[model samples]
Target: MSDLNKLGLAEARDALRAGDVTSVELTESCLKAIDEADALNAFVHKTPEIALERAKAADDRIKGGDAPSMCGLPIGVKDLFCTKGVPSQAASKILEGFKPEYESTVSQQLVDAGAVMLGKLNMDEFAMGSSNETSAYGNAVSPWRRGNDDAQLTPGGSSGGSASAVSADLCLAATGTDTGGSIRQPAAFVGITGIKPTYGRCSRWGIVAFASSLDQAGPMTKNVRDAAIMLETMCGHDPKDSTSAELAVPNFEAMLTGDIRGKKIGIPKEYRMDGMPSEIEKLWADGAAMLKDAGAEMVDISLPHTKYALPAYYVIAPAEASSNLARYDGVRYGRRAQLAQGDGITEMYEKTRAEGFGHEVQRRVMIGTYVLSAGFYDAYYNRARKVRNLIKKDFEDVFAKGIDAILTPATPSASFGLGEMTEADPVQMYLNDVFTVTVNLAGLPGISVPAGLDSQGLPLGLQLIGRPWDEGDLLNTAYALENAAGFVAKPGKWW
Candidate 1:
């Protein structure tokens, strides 16, 4: 009973069905663990009362034999999601105390499936930074420390809190949104499984807007199977989001046959970045070898536009972000700046924005504004969009040649110390997404599976990018990698 919080989603689902445990008990166990994990700073908003209430209902549903796979399983919601009446801040001060009146589409879908929401998790402010340091709630520290060094490490950003909460056993799983690798990079840093579904597969309605075209919600869980179960529930067509795909949602958990034999796995030479860590290089090679053992044919491939992906992503994401974030002025809601005597409307807007946004958020908004300005619109934004199309076409060309899945390292390196890269050039931090931005740029499905440990015993992950609308096949391939790698390392209970 005490260890119910540590159980994965599938394990808890089975335990609930078998009558060995109750949802209320599991919820209590998780709430207790979260209370003890303040040092991790993973869960920024605690909703124990709501969690227990949902758990009681789940128990009733189970008694009626109407439980879904996620019924009663305690999980965290990323702050980017607007849970009705819950503070959906997106971890930025600008939106501080701003609770949404309506629930985000993805979260509402999970509630319909009966999953319990423990609370809102922390993240990079507006999902901007690679490291979790940009979060206003403070860094969501990784549970895995450097080898006996006691240095607090960062659980990767944007989805950093989701990764930390899942890895630390504070929750069974958590919701994560990926825009330029927010979900996968952090999952890699913290040793969890996170998937960014094909763009438009998950409705963007009600989610706090960042780069609207690039944002997609997915699940971060303890294993590939758990991700499959949660992803199915999180995905569906919503009329509110014009970009939502009108397609049937598949039972992703049932499709995890782990039989990826004869599947074509593309190994892109462009992913082999200059000065990439030797350990990551070796880990990627080892992942390829394991897939070969599982009967996956590995073939060398090229995505020529890969070199321009990072630059193009930076330009385009900020441009969209600037446009989407303009509504946060003090006139509507959220924090308002104190006005000086006789200040005008322009002054009020300027003061509110300058005082509200953090360095990273402000930096992005400024860059976005500059790029979208009349003089630079064609020079930067339009050119970046063109490059983005070329990048997408590159993946299409590969898949046209029958590549079932593309394999790459999830991040350039393992988790780093909290403030190590934040003080340096911001590009040093942006480089963390080198291996991941291409996936988002192409609007494809991607997953990060914990593959192995580095020399310091910290976990590293391998990424699998799949065809558009083919997450079932993508997850199956990741399932094979998960089995082959057999990465079962857990961070010691330091938090």
Candidate 2:
């Protein structure tokens, strides 16, 4: 029998069906791992009692021969989701003691599929930073290291905690919401597999809004198979979210045949930056070669608007965030801070918001407010929207010309030291999303497959971008690549 903690969701399900391992025992092992990984600050709040009860019920379900796809599998959820009765903070003081009466559609779907909720994982306050250091709780350290390296390295943000927890065996899989490279970047940093589905495939009904238009929830897991299982469970149509498309979701688990023959793959020419490490470049070349070997055609393509994506995304995301966060101004929900004796409502609103939001959160709020302000609205916000449309058009143009999907490096570089990027200007940090955010802007689907290791031994990820509302194609292509790469996750002893 394999160690309970080492098994992914599918394997865990198999064991439960065979009566080899009970759900309670699996939940206990995950709880133990969570306790051990606590020093890494991978979680904001852990629901041990709820998890145990759920696991026991799962055991009963399996015993009675009534189990859904993910029955008995424990999953760590990022704090951005609204979990009923659980503190669903976006990892900030502003949302302190705020518990929603309703569950996020994504989290509810997971629960309905019988996945035990292990806890709420940590993240950047309102999903704002590249490094996990921006998290209000603390930083999530990468589970992997270079040889015997002892320095604490960042598990990428803002989905950093979910990535770390999955890689460290805290849960079988985890849920992550990507606004700008959140899911894919952290998976690369922590040596795990994560996929960002087509924007509208998964409902965003109860997800705490950062940039509502760009946010797409997806899965982080040990490998492609678990990712497939999670994607299948998380995707579907719900009238609750108007943005959700009305289409039939393919059987993602059944579609992972690893047969990608005669498919045309486009390699964007603009992604080859000057400072790109030799290892990453080789990985890119190797990925193209592997696709060719798999009987796929690799074509050189160009996205002219690539260079402008980062700036446009920064402007647009903050503009939307400024509008969405307005609801949290000491009135409807969240905590209210103390004001001066003479202060009534106005000062209380200002003071509460000031004390609640972290530095990065406050910074984004200010930027958003400025961009959405009356005088600058057209020049900044509207211009960014136009640029975003152009970027989306670039993808549409390639897809129209018979491209099955496009490829790029998930991040320009591998994981860095905890505080390395925080000291630099915010623009430098925003540049990390240059490759991944374009897909979000275009409402396309993308997946990050483990390609290779960098000079520092941290994982390098290869991304595949699919057409809008085509998550199935993205999953199929990623499944083929995962098979070709034969990437296996090996957690470090320190984990």
Candidate 3:
């Protein structure tokens, strides 16, 4: 029971059920770890009082023999989730000091299941950037450093803090919302497991909106089993969220039989982009080989529209974001500008937003507004939507051929040093999502599992995109990959 903070979800659950350790002990261990690791900047808000109170209650529930699988486990909630009385700023300056009176359905579900919330973790401002650099509070540094290098690296974003915290064992797991590659890309960078279920699988009620149509909340955990256990607790129908799916939640962990025999896995040709790093190419091939050796069949497939995914995503996501972010005009609950005398409402709106939003958020909002404008709506917005449909259809066509899952590199490359790409063209950062945006555009289930390390000893991940509502099968395949890869390397903890 020692190093309780390092235990994964399933291990913690089993130990709690067996009466080997108290919830307070586990919670305290994580709190201590979080207190000592401030250099990581993973936690934006620490709620020790609330965490211990919940931990005590969870221990009582376990003692009463009425405990859930997640009962007494310590975890982190992304700042995007509206935890009542806790600041849910979404790492944006516009929402500074704004605490919701009600809780997000997904976080509340975790509470109902007896999970302890360590605090709100950091992320990119309004989930706008690929690197965690856009956060108003500053970036969440990765626990993993390049070989013999002293420079800090990004944990990926906008779920950077969740990925960092989970990878560093600050908490057992954390909640992450993915609009494009927010969850999976970060998970890959940090050498952890992250899954974005089919859109609407987790209710969006009370979670801060990025792209309403594309955003889905999911678990970022240390391993695939923990991802499965936490994801089950986070998903269900919510009357408050109109898009919430009404399907029954499956026991995802139970499907980890690791028997992928006869499962047809797709290796999409379009994923082989020009100038892709040899390390990443080798990693992808190795992953496919791993799955094939695990009794699964790998077949070559084509998703011709894959090339359009990033462009379509940029247009569609920004359009939705422009609409979604219009509410934070300084006249509402968040931060407002101090206007000079005679400054009217329009000036106030202009000044407040100019001062509040970070560079990335402002850029995207402008792009979104432009795409949605009357003159260019057809050329940009409508066309992007059409391309999105084609992209989704491409997946449907492949799945119709009986491909159970599609495997690809989770990211184009491994984690880069902080501030390394700040001076580069913004498109360089967008390329980080090259292998990931297709899943979001298609609204399919995708999971990223750590497969191997590059020459610099940084981690790389393999992605599995599954049929809609088939997360169980996807997770099972990832489990097979996990077992095959045997990726047990933890970051050398300098933090």
Which predicted model would earn the best lDDT?
3
> Once superposed on the true structure, which residue ranges of model 2 sit more than 4 Å away at CA?
none
* Candidates sorted by lDDT, best first: 3, 1, 2
lDDT, residue 495, model 1: 69
- Evaluate candidate 2 by giving its C-alpha RMSD to the native, one decimal: 1.3
Candidate 3 lDDT (Cα, 0 to 1): 0.95
Minimal lDDT window, size 10, model 2: 486-495
Q: Which residues of candidate 1, in runs, are more than 4 Å off?
A: none
* Tens-place lDDT digits, model 1, residues 402-446: 999999999999999988985559999999999989999899999
TM-score of each: 0.99, 0.98, 0.99
Better of 1 and 2 by TM-score: 1
lDDT for residue 398 in candidate 3, whole number 0-100:
94
